[model samples]
Target: MKIDIAELIIVEGKDDVSALKRAVNADIIITNGLGLTKERLKEIETIAKDRGVIVFTDPDYPGSKIRNILKGRIPNCKHAYLNKSEAINPKTGKYGVEYAKPEAIVRALKNAKATVQDGSENYTLTDLVCWRLAGADSQKRREALCNHLRIGQANAKGLLNKLNAYQIPRAEIECFLAEYERGER
Candidate 1:
């Protein structure tokens, strides 16, 4: 028996469709990677108005880009965050929702969060820079932080927005950074 998801799940490709189908029952729409066109977004918006949407793309740059587009336009779509660690294909060494385990996919869907602008900027650009979450040599740190926060990987600006939009406190980021620096994370 599979889990029943009420929202329309959006993913990157057919492999993602196959993978998610193995995990749950839901209406799915494939964007074919970074190919989410205006027409497609319109279609998705129409469906989302009826059943809502869970944007569950791969845990990579392109995936993040796609999710961002949908978020900007749809405004209310739920987002699933599959850590890159769990989404990597062992043999191919590529990252995608298709590569993630069924359990991981289900877990991500179950924990999906809505990205909303609550007008709370808990952290700033300077904060990310001082915390080594931005600027040179910050990519890996950002990736690890996103994985820890289960908010998916993002570039500098996107990371800052997520840190604020998710309503994660400044103290939490500070503690996480300290733990990370101490190798106790």
Candidate 2:
């Protein structure tokens, strides 16, 4: 069934917003990871109260983390995880749903699942880091301090200066990232 959802996609950067707009007709909002402040949530909640709001994000670790964060702030905000295979190339593994082809984008929307809503669910800093690493490409250097860790390439470099190393090995970290990317765990 085709769900004509008039949802808004909250993303971490302009590129994400642009890519999503190109692929879908939904409204796009860029949070810039300021942690969904009270005012922002209020604005989002106001919109969601009447219409369905689907929080579409990158199919990486950070994307999921963003969903979790949004869940805490916005009521009636549904979440959708993009199918990495359909939205991205499994071989080259260039991450992000924007990389998805036309048909792939259609399939992604068709297969989108409802976001599980729960108030008490909480994610730790470690979880955020893991999400960032998982969202990264396999061949890319797993720099914990790299800006591109989570918010994505457009924003990663600037944030990199503010991040600290957690002693996460490139390979081990990639494995953790892979679990989410491949939807295995």
> How far out, in Å, is residue 128 in model 1?
58
Off by over 4 Å in 1: 113-185
Model 2: lDDT of residue 15: 71
User: Over the full model, what C-alpha lDDT does candidate 1 score relative to the true structure?
Assistant: 0.83
TM-score of 2: 0.49
Tens digits of per-residue lDDT for model 1 on 1-119?
67767677899999999999898866688998998889999989877876589999888899999999999999989999999899998898999898888899888987884322233
Q: What is the C-alpha lDDT of each candidate?
A: 0.83, 0.55
**Candidate 2, backbone clash total:** 4
What TM-score, computed on C-alpha atoms, does each candidate reach? Answer: 0.60, 0.49
| lDDT tens digits, residue span 16-99, model 2 | 666665655555677765455778776677656644567767778877787888787775676666677756757777777567
**Native-to-model Cα distance after best TM-score fit, residue 67 in candidate 1, in Å:** 0.6
Deviation of model 1 at 10, angstroms: 0.4
